[model samples]
Target: MPDLSHPAAHRPGHGDPDWAAMRRILVVRPDNVGDVLMTGPVFRALRAAAPRAALDLLASPAGAAAASLLPQVDGVVTASVSWQQLDLVPGSDPDAELVGDLAARGYDAAIVLTSFSQSPWPAAEVARRAGVPVRVGLSKEFGGGLLTHWVPSPPDEEHQVDRMLGLLAAVGVPSRGIALEVRVPDDAATPLAVVGERYAVVAPGASCPSRRWPAERFAAVVRALAGDGLTVVVSGTERESDLVHAVAGDVGVPLAGGLGLADLASLLAGAEVVVANNSGGVHLADAVGAPVVELFAGTETVDQYRPRTTRAEVLTRPVSCAPCRQLVCPFGQECLAISPDEVVAAARRLRAVHV
Candidate 1:
């Protein structure tokens, strides 16, 4: 039988950096909100380990908002490249501007974080060009000498939050607690009037279309949740309003437009349960300590993206073509084959457990 298990972190470095001497640090995680959120504990660990040092986050626009909400983060710089996410058209090259910004900041050391399947070299290359002498990242097959230390990462199946903390651990920064955290900034008041005191939030939009379950199924879930004496609210980015509306149908309350990132964080914090696709909402809900009913479509392995909360109930159907890593699913998309009934059941169970 094939051995299916988690991989351990491996370190291939000559010496550990002097954390005491490192004053200014840059954390490069130029992906989406979910990616940045998973890196939150790393930011916290760095602050705890180096209380005197200045920390700045280098992130994509999708990630910048969440980065600002982490109390450990001193500043956030936004730069989204074509390589970061799907549906972004060509010529999205913002590397030159990003590199100039990093070079100007004079970061003493830079740590490039990425998902298991992603290469950290591109961001690490920027750090190298910025004259950051101490660069750290996970070892990759085609790293191009972008990293000074190639640390061993845990198995690809591990939660992204734990994996990020593992990267810091390789450099001798132990984790405080492997929990996802987001500071609810006071500026984002709850979008209350329409929402009940206790409610379930359903986020039905994903950056990649293939990652979403069928819209009608999401509608069925919201309608069912409402029928079961739960107040259901549907949400997403302003760009996702159409998709969110399609999924909400008529039963769920639609707050899909106009809520800013911190506002969304506030909304999630007050939620009883978050029902969402395997998108940024999963990570956001986890960060807010909300129970998640995750309808995880296996465009990638659940190990990389599942919300890091025991309060979560993840529903997925594994297939050989899963972890296809393709933005567009070419297969029958059996990964999204889970029934709405399963999602509803999982939601009720998680809501009950968390309550």
Candidate 2:
């Protein structure tokens, strides 16, 4: 696919210098919230290496909110480019103004983060046009002379958090840690007081339908968990209210729209165990140090995208058509054919790990 209407015209390769020499750094991850959250370790390494330098993020609207939760970030600039977002309308060159604006800032170096499925060259072009001295990211095809530091991000990935940390390794800055992190705002209130103390939070929403398990199966898990004497809380964005309501039923507390992203995180932080689809909730729970049982949809390989936290378990039924990564499943969704009993058992295993 063509990338953001910008050709790889800029020449690549630059001499590496100590982290102390770079003044202002711009990090770009133009995707959803979970993708941005995965980059937290990269931002932390950059901050620890150059404490005096300003660190800025160029993110989509969804990514900027998640990026803000990382304390290491100094500023956020939201721009939805053609390559990163599926819904947005694009111009002749959607990145022209952004490139000019970024250039005016005189950032010393720019690091563009892209998924294995996406190309970093689009963002790299923006950095090059902005006159950034050094640019970095992974390359599958030839670099097209658009990157200064080329980091290797495998097509079928490893843990996303560690993969992001690998980008820092390209710059000679040692990675601090591989743990995924999110700074839940102190002002986050308890939106669902009914959840009380020890409860299992069930997040049923995934960004794409293919990544989500069947709603009926999730409801069954909630009922089974409740039967085990554990209180259940169902969480989702407003868009998934119907799905949340159906899953919550009369037994679980539906915390849809009642909680902001930070508030939802607080709820997850307090949970004894988080039962959710393989989505942002998994990452959020991991960030808050809560164990999670992921109802994974095997639309893609689990090896690369599974929960990055220590205490987590994934439940998926393998199929030949899996790892197709289709938004709309053409093969009857064999990945989510797992039973409710299996999910409850997976949750039990993850809980045992924490105990």
Candidate 3:
């Protein structure tokens, strides 16, 4: 139960002369959907700090999809380079063209948000090439030479959401009491009729294999919930049909590949609860105000990225090597081997609390 508020423990002085003159601002957060969703509070904070200033975002395709649902953003610019792919080709300069494109817009200032391990150099380089007047980011990689303002990276154990907000505070933005948000378009509300009301959503797929609880475990949870006379619907992208089908093999209705992001949001909005892995769906469920039961398999710290809502229940098994944060588990994934009955019990507890 770590505190997510008060991101900046050591507030820096706003002594920069140009801080007041900056008008148009750009935020670069080319990460995953969850990462982008977590930044919504920061985006809203930026809008509140500069009510009249135009704010733009540079994100990846997935990040852009999530950003489009945020109300504070004036526009989202899709970055051609993926962070994972960029790491593969360290010196390719694929972002060079994007820098030129952003330069043409003539942003007055920019802030780049990144984790402790990731250097903000790429975004800093783009800001420099774009000729943005004031560039702000966390001080790492000894690359402060490229930034106009620098904030120290938060301690390693700090929640990532707080860490991003720490960078925002470095540039005179307030970072307290903000909540995550997402906008579901009116048109996106149509397909949710298929789920009906009083249903639960089961998101059985995760981007990382180590993060996925066993498909059979999901099936058991679904079966138990269905047996309790609740309507259960499973949802995932088209690519995850196989995994979703495997999870729904023995219980409930298989709604796999049945909804897009917006449709999924609409459906989730109507659900009593959402049972999912520590994946994008966890954030989506939180966005729509659905109580979520998020299963964390020790791939990452539960406190760092757990859904930022009181309605959510995070379950993790304490293994000796838990929270290794590895892409692939060297040994069998014991962290996620908790019995299906245990997950169902947790889900039931969450449901009772919400009730």
Q: Which of candidates 2 and 3 is the stronger one according to lDDT?
A: 2
lDDT, candidate 2, equals: 0.80
Worst 10 residues of 2 by lDDT: 2-11
The lDDT-based order of candidates, best leading, equals 1, 2, 3
TM-scores, one per candidate:
0.90, 0.91, 0.90
Per-candidate clashes come to 3, 0, 0
- lDDT digits (tens) for residues 285-324 of candidate 1: 8888898988888778887776765488888898988777
Taking the tens digit of each residue's C-alpha lDDT, what string does model 3 give over 1-355?
A: 5654333423455344244455788888888888888888887888777777788888887778788777788888897664447255666777777878888888988888886677777678778877987778875346645676766667766777788887777667778554677888888853445555567889988888888888888998888888876788878778888887887775666776756677777888777778999898898888888889888888777777877754887888888996687888888888887787877887788788766
Query: Which segments of model 3 are wrong by more than 4 Å?
Result: 1-21, 86-92, 190-193
lDDT winner among the candidates? Answer: 1
Q: Where in model 1 is the C-alpha error above 4 Å?
A: 1-13, 82-94, 142-145
The window of 10 residues in a row where model 3 has the poorest summed lDDT is 3-12
What RMSD does each model have against the real structure? 3.7, 4.1, 3.9
